[model samples]
Target: MPTDPLERIVETAFDADVRSCRRPHSGSVAETAVLELENARGDVPRRLVCKRGGASIWTGDAIESAVLRVLEQRSDLPVPGVLASGKIVGERGSARETDPLERWACYEFLEGTNPGPGYATLEPTVRRRLVADAGAHLGRLHGTPGLEFDRVGGLARGENGTDLVLCEPTGWHAVDSDTLREQLPISVPPTGDSGRRPVLTHGDYQPSNLLVDDSGAITAVLDWGNAHVTHAEYALARAEVRFVDSYVGRLSRAERRRLRSLFRAAYARYAPLEAGFDRRAPLEKLRWVAQSGSNYARLLGDSRGRRQLWRQFRRLLE
Candidate 1:
């Protein structure tokens, strides 16, 4: 694809006085372009990020843009303001065929830098604070009420909101699928019905999705493509695992304990889970971890033209 084509699309889409446009390599799935718009007619200069869908993954960019627009109107949480979103017609190759890509979204560019790899080397106190902040933000997001979106609300069960971490169909991860029909039981069930509640959650809560400013404060959370309404404990469990993995090397034993406590304590304020019902009991979690190694092995299997299905059974032993 021609690089300038994306810039031209953005320019025409917004009709703003654009100064320059450059592609950014930060995102994994989308074709992202950062555009700088010139200030004119009393309009302030602005930075915008345009995201277009790629071939491999399901582009939920349009859904995310719609959801964020709703979330932005509310004052309780922090979210990037969405500017515009629509399809950009383009011809691929000599076929005179115009492909209508279903997913496209764009938002105002956030100015702060990502909290660098220094997070991996931070002191125990700072690490704990990061986890606490993440947990707090998550609690706030889950606590905020009454958000409605057509596409997000329509996400298939066990698809976006529910953590199907363990129940993904065998070999489904190797290539994306429309529907995965494996309903493995929760590995860790909550003690009682206390943990279940109707609430909003940032379904994808990994550390890379968070944006920390230069002052070490988390300024904004990005990537709500997977956001949805679900049980609050499920969201907490996902966040805790992500936090532990992100700071595994830097946290001392005591620090890890304190961080866990902080996260649980904060999460409990808004949506409390049952006590004593091992929080990590979801079978899906173990299945997900095992699938990671399984995916790795599958890669090797493909290179050698071999089929492997019992990798998970073997992974269970390791």
Candidate 2:
């Protein structure tokens, strides 16, 4: 097999004559390949993750890099450490210097299994414990004193090298049933100047993004691609929906009840959501799913998979 041109470009990225580079799986908005890097002596090799974003997807790579730095400096969150970041000329020093968005970055590779889809398959006791553990970790993340922001929503890099904003397309308003019925053609219900304060959220915290060791220990929280600032309840609802979904098709009703009990018992310690969280959760879930539709569609990579997302999206609206 001939050396891939992309691989050569990534080699120039790390400035090392690499050994092997391969894509681990299909990614939605970015193409990611795991590269085993050799040190100067070529013996002490390091594993790194290389990612190149698609043309239209701008999920704030710079912001994510900044978040990773904050996590590395401030918390014990198990996330990828940024290795080689910032803009680089594609095929440096060549005739085709290329666009800035065509840049790439490297991160420390994480190793573990994502036990999301088969979460219910674990022993009953283990499932219960994992839920609690997940809740505690989420609480820890939420407990971190969030960065100061002027408003609530997605973050963006500013012209002064630190311009974060409360981006509108980020989350939804917690509207009532009547509002759901009188819905507009807008993404989320209209709630002008609602003072729901923003907090640091995982943006897409769920079982699938968590990596656990064989011993059932949570190792790393992967994919900060969707991490941003949002309403605390908005984050909670998105996570809760995912928790229920993991067991929905796999377990019996009684079994699901058992797990839900365990999940909420732990989640309560962290979330400040009121009794109406469930009533407002559907709208919140819909908000997240809609904004993330393209990313997930690209991850699905097929018509059938994309249709499944559409089905879910429409159901949420109803």
Candidate 2: worst-modelled 10 consecutive residues by lDDT: 188-197
TM-score per prediction, in order, is 0.67, 0.70
- The regions of model 2 sitting more than 4 angstroms off are 1-6, 26-28, 40-45, 54-62, 90-101, 148-150, 160-196, 270-283, 286-318
> In model 2, what are the clashing residue pairs, if there are any?
158-163
Model 2 clash number: 1
Highest-lDDT candidate: 2
Model 1 vs. true fold: TM: 0.67
lDDT of 1 by residue, 214-301 (tens): 4446777777765555445555665776776446666666766677788877766654557753544243344336644664565445
Off by over 4 Å in 1: 1-3, 39-45, 54-62, 90-102, 147-192, 228-230, 277-284, 287-318
Tell me the tens digit of each residue's lDDT in model 2 across 202-247: 6667777777776666777766655676665566666766766445
lDDT, candidates in the order shown: 0.53, 0.58
- Residue 231 accuracy (lDDT) in model 1: 48
| Model 1: ten consecutive residues of lowest lDDT | 148-157
